[model samples]
Target: MLPRRFNLHRPDRIEDAVALLAEHGDDASPYAGGTELLIAMKARVLSYAHIVDLKGIAALRGVSARSDGGLIIGALTTHHELANHSLVLERLPAYALLSANVANIRVRAAGTLGGNLCFAEPHADPPAMLCALNAELVLAGPGGERRMLLAEFILGELSTARATGEVLVRIEVPGLPAGTRAGYRAFGHLERPAVGVAAVALPLGKGFDWRLRVGSICGRPTALAGLEKAMRGLPEADALAVLAEGAEQAAAAVEADDDIRGSAEYKRHLVGVLARRAARAALGMEALAA
Candidate 1:
């Protein structure tokens, strides 16, 4: 149950919400769908005397296509909305499918993508995919709005680069390049992921280009830059072998911790296994329909 004496302020305007946050400082926290924040509060892990309810802000909802061919999702857009959106399914089926499978139906009903990303939970799904797609985040603050890479927005477990007085207003996913394919692989039990890998392959002239990221092993998602560099220009069979080997090496590159999820070494092995699978999926060898 929520604390009996805490104050609630409903702000329909972004500027007003930021002003309240500026006034209350650490005492104030923004409230979205509250799927994550409220649970933490009820567990006594976090306490805020002032809750700045942002659900009243009409501007922070919906999806639209940008002229650049990117997709803009509002901060208030729920997991359910995005998962089933026609345009999302049409343009970025990989992302649409990922959104569809986030947690359970109940959590998807109450959780907002903005909340998920803003919370920066390490074990969640969107971060790795966002990183591979080179997504951008739009933040609104006292100075107006600014854009940041989704990769930079998430700093660590339950941490983000968002300032106290700023709010993430939208997520921008760039248009997929011609002949580019994307895939994501994750393994978990009890609704918590142990390892998640994302792969994107682009056909460039006479060769293939790859982008890979390994997540849920450490505090932050890690890109496999070395592996991508090595895979460049390799033939089909050669690329598969290199991806497998690189997956093992990718494990070493991440600073995974030994926690209840699994041992560090065990998690590293999962990264390799999933990386190969994800690579195949990205290459359209083993594809899933949204």
Candidate 2:
């Protein structure tokens, strides 16, 4: 099926794009990589009379290092670019690996990070890791720019906190402390993950600061707060035991729904398995063969 007829407007500036969105109101959408939007439009699941193309806005592209030893990634950047970019590979190789495996090569080539988040598909991968890394989103609007934690930006499945005319400009990942390591694990069928987990381990003397996030099995990414609290101050070996033992209980606390992907029980099981694997990977342990 063909997308309903629409007028495409290319705006070179962020303000201009916001203006177009504001002017059209609900009739328009800010277009980046059209991967998700185009699919919905083509299926007639969504219809927009005006499409505000943001690709012409040069400010929304590229990967650069931050003075704080973190990263600033343009929202409009493609997954393929991120996977191969030097700074991304050097600073957050786990993220780079995740980007490299998103869907297929074609989607990675054309899909933009901003689009993926704005679309807010529950089965997507980036949100989990971004949340674990404590990433923040910078949004541009007629009122000027406002920033929020990425975890707060996503309201639920297929929904977000973006206002009427706000445009997501960039994603900010804070620097990890020395000796910090991060890892991500996801399992699924079709092209999307059924359950994805991201783990970050920051050394705190002999103990560790553990951040864990589980995604795709629920409406939005869920932090394993219970497990994190239990493992936070434990020695390396003890922490691993806590994580391995508590993973299933922690996963069961999150509400998983039955879907075409799998039964809620199965997804919860996957969550536990992946969470333990991700935490181990973050601790520089070897991956166990399937």
Candidate 3:
């Protein structure tokens, strides 16, 4: 149960929400779907005097196509909606797959993409996948609306660039070229294998271009840009070697922790393995068609 003394503020408009946040500052926490926030509150990890629920605001829901052939997902759209949306499945299958695998059916039903990102859990899935797809985050606050890359938005573990009154409005994923295919993979614990080392990969242009993001095992999901760079213009054998090298480099860069789930060394190894598997799956799909 949540703390009894706290107040709940349900604003009908985004402006009102911002005003409340600006006025109350740290005392007020913006509530999206509340899957993580509520749980944290119950666990006493988060304590706030007032809750600004964003669900009643109509602006924070739905999935729509952008003019640039990408997608604009509202902050409050539930994981269930994203996983099953026709447009999402057709165009951004990587995201759809990631959404489906976030947790069990009930958690997916209750969790919102915005809430997941806002929580910024080190083991979260969406952030890394968004980074792989080169997604951007839109924010609204007292200073006015602005956009930032996903990498920039997630500054560190359990942290973001959102200021005192800023709220994430939506996430925008730009279009990919034709002949692109994407996939997501994860290795969970024995009892919950689905939540462990998660990886997403995208292959484009008849396999000429590729990208992959690995999450859920480190402090944050990391984009394999170095791997993508090394694989550019290389043949299959050379590309695989480059990918492995890049994975090693990325693993080296990660600052993981020794948690109940696994040791830091194990998590780093998981990242490398998942990265290779995801990349291979994406590239293998391309090979089968050719």
Candidate 4:
């Protein structure tokens, strides 16, 4: 059971939610699906006197296609809903696949996309995938709404660009071109291979336009730009070699934390391997597109 002393406030509108957050400020935590927040509270890792529940706010839920052929996903949209959405499956198939694999049915049923992104856990899957697709975050605060790229939004381990009195309202992902193909792959621990090092790759055009992002191995999910640059103007074999080199460089650039899952070095190596595999899959998609 949850603590009895904490107060819960359910706001019906976005303005009210923002007002409550501004009023309570640091003392109040915005509750989405309550999957991570409740668990953290139970473990004593996070404490808040008041909980601002976002569920009643209808503005923060749903998925719809934008006028520009992109997709806008509200903060309260659950993982299960995302995984099953026909528009998401048609427009962003790789993300749908990744969403379907997060934890299991129960967790997926309770977890919200914005909540997952807000948590910014290194092992989490969505941020990396979002980064791969070049997703944008829309935040609303007292100062008004502002947008930031996915990479900027997720700064480091368990940290985000979200400031006090700000709410992450939605994520906007632009549509990919006709030749684009993206894929997500990972290797988990011996006991839990399902949750291991997750990597995502997006192939744009044939030569230099391919993009890649890898997550769940480093402190923050990162775009593999250096690797993508190295692969540019190269043939498939050369691109693969460049990708491996870029993975090494990326591993060196970030400090992968060691935990119950594996050691730092082990995680780095896992990222490297998964990066290569993801790169190869992306190349295969490119070939099919060609």
Candidate number achieving the greatest lDDT relative to the actual structure: 2
- lDDT by residue for model 2 (1-290), tens: 99999999999999999999999999999899899999999999999999999999999999999888899999999999999999999899889988988999999999999999999999999999999999999999989999999999998999999998889999999998888888899999867999999998888868899999998887789999999999997898899999889998998898899999999999999999998899888777845221
Whose lDDT is higher: candidate 1's or candidate 4's? 1
RMSD for each model, in Å, please? 1.6, 1.4, 3.3, 3.4
Q: Each candidate's TM vs. the true structure?
A: 0.95, 0.98, 0.88, 0.88
Please write out the lDDT profile of model 4 over residues 232-269, one tens digit for every residue. 65666777777766676666655666778888777777
User: Candidate 1, residues 144-247: lDDT per residue as tens digits?
Assistant: 89999999888999889999878889998888778777888888775868888888877865557888888888777898888888888777678888887667
Look at candidate 4 and give me any clashing residue pairs: 188-193, 188-196
lDDT for model 4: 0.75
State the C-alpha lDDT per candidate: 0.85, 0.91, 0.75, 0.75
Cα lDDT, model 1, residue 288: 45
Task: List clash counts for every candidate, in order.
Answer: 0, 0, 2, 2
- Mind giving the per-residue lDDT tens digits that candidate 3 earns over 1-290? 65546899999899999999999999999998777888888978889998999989899888999887899999998889998999898887767876877678888898899888888876676777688777899999998999998878887778888888888899999887665555556676742332233233344333356666666665556666676766765665677787777776677666667777788787777777776766665555422111
Global CA lDDT of candidate 1, please?
Answer: 0.85
In candidate 3, what residue range of length 10 has the lowest lDDT sum? 191-200
